[model samples]
Target: MLVLLPPSETKAPGGDGDPLDLAALSWPELTDVRAGLVEALVELAGDLPAARAALGLSPTQDDEVARNAELLGAPTMPALARYTGVLYDALDVRSLTRAQRARADRRLAVGSALFGVVRATDRIPAYRLSAGSALPGRPTLRALWRPTLGPLLAAVDELVVDLRSSAYAALAPVPGAVTLDVLCERPDGTRVVVSHSNKAHKGRVARLLATTTGEPGDVVRLRALLRRAGFHVEHPGGTALTLVVPADWATR
Candidate 1:
């Protein structure tokens, strides 16, 4: 789905490899995602069945959040509903009538676009860190790098801008990349890291490595190397990537 054949201008001067799979989602899928969001919003707003009736949704709307989250791989439908409710309240979304959710959904849609879930599978052997503790920095932050970094980084940066610095990662198409750039939140020093991944596959690939961490305000070197790796990487719009960091990871 990511690659839908090359773009119109492959040999042309401005041509950048094939177009990514950022096409408009199928209507049904969009509807499913939207419906899930609406239901979650209504439920969070108060009244469950009334929200469903108001939205013209079916009983299944009750399960839509979980269902949609599972399909979209988002946190959870209820979680989304809860977060979205928060966004709505913050932005005064509840009072906005029909015209508003339509407009606001655009931003949510962009958040969806920013995510590249396929990349998760690539980190099967990734280092796991607890929620409270730091994700490792500096010396311990040199393990996450992949060849796909060249093709995926820029998109991710754009996504970070859209998601406002929310959590994001990329898994190479082939998962054969030599390194990884993990975004973590440490207490004392660094906030993100770029290290060598695929160590378990070392016997098969031989380019085993470690990791590196840095501040969101300064990851240009890492971004450039990832681009060189053939990944269409982009530094997240400062606001976007920074916005996504967890409470502990955020500027403290």
Candidate 2:
């Protein structure tokens, strides 16, 4: 089976002299890193039609055809993310071309800055529900994506997770609606805005924060293994320790 990998720069890149280098890097640089993602996607799956569907696209996916057409010649984040969305669309699978996978890996290894969004619209409930990172001072933005595809999209959940970065990138379509918007605002302000803007339907999101009940060693090993198997795993913040395995590793 073909195992997909994420982009490498997802983790906050560190240079001897430039800790903020990752932040200052231009969109083109991010695009280069995104290209590597397509390379990995190609290695794992050769069928474009299949890949497109898995990323949550339909046979009538004419809209993305030209948008990502340039990707055929060069690997880039837009091309790869667009392609990944197509694959997830068709396959009913959550596939990250390179950037998302890489970012997920980083959050798993080293600690990461994440923003949380809630379900609501206009003068909504507070979104900084304890786990939210305070914003306004620190401006970290992340792309939001649906972790599952297919009829799953019908379930309706968006902004399942928000990754914190220097610049905000456009996110994939909302699981059911288009709530994830891209802008660089302070962290707290961003969360508040997202929380207040989008509406939510309960019981749709994956339990990434499920708590770990197993021994730390066992949990760590399982998490590492899941990552090695090429998945963007999530933790359900509990003692039970859940692993959201990628479709490719479902049998293994």
Candidate 3:
């Protein structure tokens, strides 16, 4: 099974691995587009004010732009190790056993604006670019990615679990992939879509899915696996599952 994860805005800086090699990344077909974006970003970085404006950064986030400037020369690390945030924090990949980490490397692929999609083991450098950002002299990133990325993702043979946030998902959509939603159940039986803690729940679910020996080929098996992992999973509709948490889930 393949799990598509969203890339985090905040990434762990520096790495021990060699600099990123586009030819060595998972999708060689995306190299041209990747090279294009890298050139655009590198050029933009020469003008910090323009780069900052293009990346939607404030004064404090200038470091992010600097990171972009050094994207080509910076040391790299596995994509899974590079990303960080509430979701990744919950994933806690650093704590996984060797076998589990191997499984994660095989099953996970992160949606990226600059690289298209990177496998868990793909080497990447610390850089700042959001799927929503419009680089100078380029069409929308969605436009740039959709032509190549969509076909590539749509061709995946495994049951794909798409957990990307809307922006990244907009870049490339896996046809018929099961999308998950985390909801909060109130005492009165009404359910509200989880906002703050949703990433954490998705992260946990991803960790469970990643570590398991079972391969869930469809929504049914996927639901079963999540339930087995102690999550309150419900099939709400077509190709979608809702993981319900208590209303006070965040506090807990």
Candidate 4:
């Protein structure tokens, strides 16, 4: 089973791995799109002020523009280790067992604005690009990615558990992919969609699914697997499930 994760705006900078290599990345069909974006970004980096404006950055974020300038020659790190945010902080890949980490590498892939989708083990450099950003002399990122990404995801022969945020998910709609939603349950038996803690809950779900020996390739197996991992999961028809968490948990 493949688990699709969203990329974080905040990433861990610097790495010991070699520079980015398009041929070595997964989903080879996306190489052309990735290459085009990389070239556009590299060129955009030529004018720091213009690049910062195009990327919607404030004056304090000048370092991010510098990072973009070094995209090709910068050191790289595994995608799993590169991102840091509410979700990634919760997953804490560095704390996983060796076996669990190995399983994570095999089952996880992150949806990126810069590289399309990168496997957990794929090596990538530090770069600044938001899924919503518009580069100069190019179409919107969604337009560029939609054509190729949808077909590539649809062809995958695995039960895909999509955990990407709405922005990244808009780039490619995976056919038959099951999406997981995080909800907070109140004391009065009411449930509301979680906001701030949504990413944290999804991260925990990803870690649980990644470490487990069970292979859930369908809704039935997926629900069962999450239940066994101690989640209050509910299938709300179609290809989506809701994991109900305690209201206190979200508040915390």
Ranked candidates, highest lDDT first: 3, 4, 1, 2
Cα RMSD (angstroms) for every candidate in the order listed: 19.1, 20.6, 1.0, 1.2
Each prediction's TM-score versus the true structure: 0.22, 0.21, 0.97, 0.96
Clashing pairs in 3: none
Stretches of candidate 1 above 4 Å error?
1-88, 109-160, 166-252
lDDT of 1 by residue, 1-252 (tens): 111110010011111223222132322323333343333432332554544443344676455422322232222211112222222223333444555444333322212211222120111111111111112121111122223232443343322212111122222122221123234445554555321111111111111001112212233543553344443343454321121123242222
| Worst 10 contiguous positions by lDDT, candidate 3 | 191-200
- Per-residue CA lDDT of candidate 3, range 28-86, in tens? 99999999999899899999888988899998999998898898999999999999988
Clashes of each: 48, 44, 0, 0
When 1 and 4 are scored with lDDT, the better candidate is: 4
Top model number, TM-score: 3
Superposed Cα RMSD, model 1: 19.1
Candidate 4, after superposition: displacement of residue 48 in Å? 2.6
Q: Show the lowest summed lDDT stretch of 10 residues, model 4.
A: 189-198
Q: Write the per-residue lDDT of candidate 4 for residues 139-243, one digit (tens) a residue.
A: 999999989998889889999999999999999889899999999988998989876779999999999988888888799889998898799999989889999
**Cα lDDT of model 2 by residue, 155-205, tens digit:** 322222222122211222222221112222343533222221111100011
Q: Which ten contiguous residues of candidate 2 have the minimum total lDDT? A: 120-129
Q: How many pairs of residues in model 4 come into backbone collision?
A: 0
